[model samples]
Target chain A: MTKTKKIPVSLTLASNRDKSDHLAGFLSISPWLIGFILLILGPMLASLYLSFTDYNLLSSPSWVGLANYRSLLTDARFLKSLEVTFTFVFVSVPLKLIFALALAMLFNTGRKGSSFFSAVYYIPSIIGGSVAIAVVWKQLFGRQGAVTQILSLLNITDANLIGNPDTALSVLILLVIWQFGSPMIIFLAGLRQIPIELYEAASVDGASKWRQFFNITLPMLTPVIFFNLVMQTIQGFMTFTQAYLITGGGPLDETLFYAVYLYETAFEYLRMGYASAMAWVLLIIIAVITLIFFLTSKYWVFYQSEGGR
Target chain B: MHSNKRLLSDMIFYVFVIAIGIVMIYPILWMIASSLKPATEIFNNAVSLWPSAFVWENYPSGWAGFGGIGFATYFRNSVMITSIVVVGTLLTGSIVAYGFARLEFKMKNILFACLMATIMLPIQITLIPQYIIFNEIGWVNTFYPLLLPGLMGGQPFFIFLLIQFIRGIPRELDEAAIVDGCSKLGIYWRIILPLLKPALVTVALFCFMWTWDDFLAPLIYLNDASLHTVTIALRNFMDTQGSTSWGPLLAMSSLSLLPQLLIFAFFQKHLVQGIATTGLK
Candidate 1:
C-alpha cells in the first residue's frame, strides 16, 4: 500500500506536511482498510480460488481445474436457479420501476400533504423484506388468506398463491412491486431537479399534459430512470430473504432463486466448491448485466448538463 | 367555469392519491386487525377491519413465545445488536469517509474506486468465505459475526454516503481549525464531527432499521433459539405442524412492525431529506 513521491526542495514544508497528511489519512481510514482486506478482498480472492477447486470446509481444497464451472453446464438445478433469478429480475424490475415512476409523478403534483402520503407509501420498502413481512405475506395469500376471501367475494375461484407452483413466483413479484418506495423517493427527487420552466413553456404552446410529460418530463428523467433500473435489477437478482423464508424455494422448486440455491449448496448441502462456483457465475452475470446497461445507456439516458435535445 | 373544472380535477386527483395510500397500507392494517381477532375468527374475518372480539390475550400469549423463550428475549437481542451496530457504523463510517473526503494519500483514488465498486458487489460472492472465516474463529452462533464487520466499516454504502456529506462541508472550516493549532484528528472531532450530525443520524437510522429487520445474518449465525432475532422468532411460531396459532403469530408480527413504524413516523423529514440529498447526488 505504499507509493513513491518526488517533492521539489522549494516546497519542502508542503512536502513534509504531505508525509504527515498521508499518515493521518491512513490512520483515519484504517478500519475500512483492515475490514476491506479481511472481510472483502480476502474473501473475494478465496472465493475465486474456491470456485476453481473442490472443498467442503473439513478437508483441504483440492484443485479441480474448471470442473465446477464445467459441471454447471449440465447441472439441472443450477440451470433452473439461473432461470428463476432471471425471471425474477426481468419481471420485477420493470414493474417496480413503472410503479415507482407513476407514484413519483402523482406525488410530484405539488398537491397538499403529498410528502406525508409519500412517507406513508415508503413504509413497505422500509420493512417489506423482513421475515415478519414474508410470514404475513405467506398467510395473506394462503388457502384461507384474505386474498382468497376477497376473490371469493368477487366470485373468482379460490387459489392458494403461496402453495400453488404456477402462481407462487407471481406472489413474490407482487411483494417486490409492493416495496417500490425507495425508487419512488428517488424518482420524486429527480422530478424536483427537472426545471419547472420546461413544463410551463409546453403549456403555453398548447401542449396537453401527456404531451408535456413525454416531450419535456420523460427525457429529463432518463438518467434517474437509468439509475433506478441498474440498482433495482441488481437488488431483484439478489433477493433471497422472502424466497428463503416464505417459499423455501418450494412447491416444486418454482422459486429457487440463485442466492437461495447458493446458500443451500454451501451450507445445507455442504458443497462449498460448487456454491463458490455458483457465486462466481452470479458475479459475472451481474457484472455483465450492469456493463450492458452502461453500454446501452448512451442512447436513451439524456443529461441536462449536456444540453438536452 | 374553467376554475370550477380545475377544482374538480384536483378533487379527483386527491381521491386517487388516497385510494393508492389505502392500497399501500392495507396489508399492515389487516395484520393489526387480525391480531385482535380470536383464533377461530382470524381467517373467518380476515377481510374485515373490525374484529368480532378483541382478543387482548394474544399480545401476552405471543410474548410468551414458542418453547417459552419469549418475544422479550428476541426484542432485547435486536435492540442490543442494532444499537451497537449503529454506533459502530456511525463512528467507522464517518472516520473513513473523512479520509476519503478530505485527505490525500497514496493510492487514494484507487482505494476510493474499490470502495465504490464494493458497494455494488453482491454479498453472495463473499458469503461463503466470510462464513468460513467466522467459523474458524468460533464466532458462529454469536452476535460477533453480525456486529464485528460493522465495527470495521464493512458497510460501504454508509461510508460512501458520509463521504458525500463530509465533502460538501467547506474546506475553509478545517483550514481555520488547523491554523488555530488543531491537529487533523482534532479538526475531525471538533469541527467536522459536529457538522456531520444530520448525516450521522441518517447513518444511524439506516443501520438500526437494516439490522433490526435483517433475517439472513441472524438466521445463519445464531442457531440457538434463545439467541434468535424477532424475525427468526416470528419464523419459529410457524412450525411445520398444522397447529400454528395465527392469533399469536400475527400479534407478534404486528409488534415487530412497531419499532420501524415509530422510527419512520418521527424521522419522516430526516428520512426523506436523507434520501433526497443522497439520491440526487
Candidate 2:
C-alpha cells in the first residue's frame, strides 16, 4: 500500500501506467477476447485433450490415452473421407488456381469493358454454395436435364451426369472451379503490382514475351502465387457446402468430404466428442501441409517486400 | 507487341478467356432461364439459351408456402437478421478494433495475437459447446446466439480488418481529439467513426451477406416454424415432412436470391475492396 500516487522512478511509473492500461485494454477487448477464450480457445484446448479420450456428449471424457488417434489409424470411414477430401483438395485447387490466373491474365488485357467482364465472372463466387445454385445445378444435370436437351440436337439422349457416381464428384469440382473470381481478383492485383519497367526492360533485352514471363513475371508474382496456393489448398480441403447441397455426398458417398462427414457427425448425430477429435485431426493435417509450405517457401516464395514482411 | 504471333496469341487468349467466362456463366444463365421455363419445358430447353414460353408466374408459384408461410415473410426475416447483425457488428467491432489498434496496454500483443489465432479454429469445433451454451441459457431458438455475437466484437477476421484499416489513418487524429478535450470513446465515436466509412461499409457488407446466406445456424437453432429464417425454411420445404413441389421451390429460391443479388450489385465496389483487403492481409 506504500505505492506512490505520482512515482518519478521509471520502473514504478511505467508499471503503474501499464497496470491501468492493462486493465483498460483487457476490459475493452473483453468481448471477443473473453468469447475467444471461453467459447473458442477453451473448446479448442478441450478438443486437443478430448482427442485422446472416450468421451461422448452424454458423459465425462475418460483418459483413454490415444485410443481415438489409434482408432483413426484403423477407421475406414475416416480414412475414406481423408482420401475424398484430399482428392477434392488436389483436384479443385489446381483447377481453381489455373482458371483464376488464366482469367486474370485475360482480364489483364486492355479490352473494352473488361471490368464489366470481371464483375460478371465474379457473380458465382458471391452466390456460392447457396441451396439455390446447387438446386440449379441439380436441375441442369438431372437425368432429363439440360445436358440431355443439348444432346437432343445431335439425336442423342438419356445420358445423365449427376446420377453417375464417378462423374457426380466432378460436378462438385466444377462448382468449386466456377467460383474463381475472388482468387482471380487477387491474381489481377498481383499482376498489376508487377513493375511495368521490368516487362519493358525485358522487351529491350531481346527477351521473348514467353521468356519475360518465365524469367521476370513469374519470379515477381511467386509470393502471391504461393500465398494463393496455401490459402486455396486449406480452403479446398474444407469443402462442404457445394458437396452438402449439391450431392449430399451422394450417389453412394462419392462426394462425402471430410468437413461434410464432420458436420454430419457433429450436428446430425450429436457425437460432439468424436467430431471434436475429427476437427483437431483436420487442423493437424492443415498444420502439417502449411508447415511444408513454410519450410519450402524459401525455395519458391519470392517475397519482394522489404525482407519478406 | 502486335507482331502477328503476339496478335494471334492475344486473340487466342481472348478466346480462351471467353471460353472460361462461358463456362463460369452458363450455369447461372441456364438457372435463370429454367426458372422462367414451364415445368414441362424446363428439361426441354435445358441447353437452349432461350425458353420457348416463359412461365413467369413460376416465380410466385415457385415461392409458394415457404414453411407454410409466404416467401415475403422469410425474406423479411432475412432482412431483419442481416440488418441487426450488420449494425450490431459495426458498433462493437469497430470500437474494439480501435482499442486494439491505438491503445497502449500491457499484454496487448498477447491478447491480440490470441484473438488472431482463434480465427484459425474452424467453426465446427466451437459449434457443439456453443449449442450447449445457448441451450443452457435458454436462447435455443432466439436471435440471441446469432445476433448477440456481432454486438460483441465480432469474428477476429473483421476485427483484424478494422485494426489494419484504422492503422492507415493518422494517429494525429486521436491526439487532435484529445487536445480538443475529447474522451477516448469520443475520439472513436466522433473522430474515427466518420473517417472509417470505407472499412465500416466493408464490414457491414460482409455481415449482411454472411448472415443472410447463413443456412447452418438457422438450421441448428430454429425449431419453431413461425420463427424460421429463409434458409432453413426454404430447405425444409424442399423436404416434404409433406408433399414437396419443385416449381414453387425454385420460385421461392429466386425470391430469396433477389435481395442478395441486389446487395451484391449495389455494394460490389465495397465487396471487391473487402475481399481484396482480406487477401492482402
Candidate 3:
C-alpha cells in the first residue's frame, strides 16, 4: 500500500524475473547450443583447416597451402563430378518441378479421389532415396530388365540404359523425377492457399482458363515455385545413393555425384584433407546458389502481403 | 448435353489420374511381385505383375543374409537406431522450440537465425571433420557418430517446425500457468508439451523415416558386418549376390521398405500436413 516502497520492490522483482527467464531460456536450449558448437560449427572450422593440410586418417595434418584446392581444378574426376552434379541439378530440378506442378494442378481440380491419388504419388518420395529403390531402379533399367524387354519390342536391342554413359545420368534423373510427389504436395498446399475469389474474378472478366492460370494462379504460386526450386536444386546436388548404387558412377564416371566422389575420397581412399577441401568447395557452391536464389527471388517471387511486385 | 460433357470429362480425369498413378507405383509393385517370383521367372517374366507361383522361400532365404549375419540383425539395428534418434529428436526439438517460442533472452533472435541457417547447411562440410573427431576418439565403427548428432539437436528443421507450432499456442495459457507459480520448465511440460502432440508426431514420423532410410551415415560409421543397418545390409546383399539371387534380393528389399510403407500408410495425413506446414524434409 505504500507507493514508493512498492515501486522499488516491484523493480527488483521484475529484474529477478528477467534473470530467471534468461537462465531458463539458456538451460532449455543448451542441448542445441552445445550441438551447434561441437557438431556443426567446430567441425566446419576443422574441415576448413583440414582442407589446406595433407592429412590422411592416420597421419597428423601437414599443411600444403592451396595445393589441394589447386589439384581440385585439374582433377578430372572432380571436374566430371561437377559436370555430373550440375547436369543433374539443372535437368532434374526443372523436370521434377514441372511434373510436380502439373500433377499438383491436376489434383487441385477437387476431384473426389484426388487425396488418394496424391497419397499414392507420395509413396515413392518417402522411399525413393533408399537402397532398395536404387536397386529397383537399376534392375528396372538394366540390360535384362523390364524396360529393355519392352524397348526391345520396338527394335531397341540390348539397350542397357544404366550401363551406357550417355543415358546413365538420364536414368538417375528419371528416378529422381519419379519422386516428385513431395514438391507436388507442397504445390498442392500452395494452390489451396490461393483464394477461390481470384479465379472467380478472372472468369467474370472473361479470362480463359489459361489466362486465369497465368494471371491469377501462377503469380500467386511463384513463392512456392521458388521454394521448391531452391530445395530441389540443393537436394539434387547432394544426390549420392542413386548414382552410387545404380551406376556406381560407372561406364566412365558419368553418374558420379559430387557427394559420392567426396565419400570415396574421404572414407574409401582416406584422403581426409583432400576430401575436406572438396567439402568446403561444395559448401561454397551451395551457399552461392542459395544466395543467387534469394537475390533473384525478389524479381519473381510474389508475396501476397506485398500485393505483387 | 451438358451433363454428358461433364460425365465424359470426369471419366477422362479419373482415367488420367489412375493411369499416371499406376505408372508412378509400378516400380514398387514390380519389386514386391518380383520378391515372390522364382529367380528364372523374375527376369523372364519381368513384365508380368503376376507370379506363376509364389516362392515364399525368398523371404526366409533373404532373411538368412550373408557373412553369417542375418536380416534380423540388420532390422534390429535399424529399429534401435531409428527409435532412439526419433525420441532424441522429439525431446531436444521440443525443448529448444519451447525456449525460442516462450522465453525472452539475449541474442535469441540471432541464435534462432543461426538455427534456421543450419537447416540448409550441407552435411558434407561437417562429415569429414566429425568423422575425424569420432575416429580420434575410437568412436568410429560404432553408433556414436550416427546417434550423437541426433541426441544433441536432432535436426534444425525439426526444431524450426516445433517452434512454429509452439508459437501458435496461446500465450495466455503460459501466463495463467505462471500466475499459478508454475515454473518455466513446468509450463513447457504441463502446458506446451501436451499441446504439441500433432507437431511432435510429425517430427517423430519424419525422423523415423529419414533415419531408417539413411544409408550414408550408417555406411560410414558402422563398418563391421555385424553392426550393419538394413540399408547397408541390403547394399551388401546386392554386392555379394549380384544377379544370382534376384528373388531373395528383391525379397529383402521389399522387407526393408515394409516399415516405411506401413508408417506412410497409417500416418499419411500427419506426413502430408507436416510438409504443408513446414515445407521441409
On lDDT, the leading prediction is 3
lDDT of 2 at A42: 72
- Model 3's alpha-carbon lDDT is 0.91
- First chain TM-score, candidate 1: 0.95
Q: Which ten residues in a row have the lowest lDDT in candidate 3 chain A?
A: A1-10
Better of 2 and 3 by DockQ: 3
Question: Any runs in candidate 1 off by more than 4 Å, and if so which?
Answer: A1-10, B240-242
Clashes of each: 0, 3, 0
- Which candidate order results from sorting by TM-score in descending order? 3, 1, 2
* True contact recovery of candidate 1: 0.78
lDDT of 3 by residue, A120-194 (tens): 999989999999998899898998899878988898756698888888888899999999999999999999999
lDDT tens per residue, model 1, A1-309: 122353556468777899999999999999999999999999999999999999998999999989999999999988998999899999999999999999899889888989888998888888898877887788888888998788878887657878888889998999999998888999999999988888888888999999988987899989999999998898888889999988899888899999999999999988899999999999999999999999999999998888767
What's the CA RMSD for each of the models? 2.8, 3.6, 1.9
Shift of residue B115 alpha carbon in model 2, Å: 2.1
1 or 2, which is superior by lDDT? 1
DockQ of 2: 0.53
In the predicted model 3, the residue pairs found to clash are: none
Q: Kindly report the docking quality category of candidate 1.
A: medium
DockQ of each: 0.72, 0.53, 0.83
lDDT minimum window of 10 residues, candidate 2 chain A? A1-10
Cα displacement (angstroms), candidate 3, residue A210, comes to 1.1
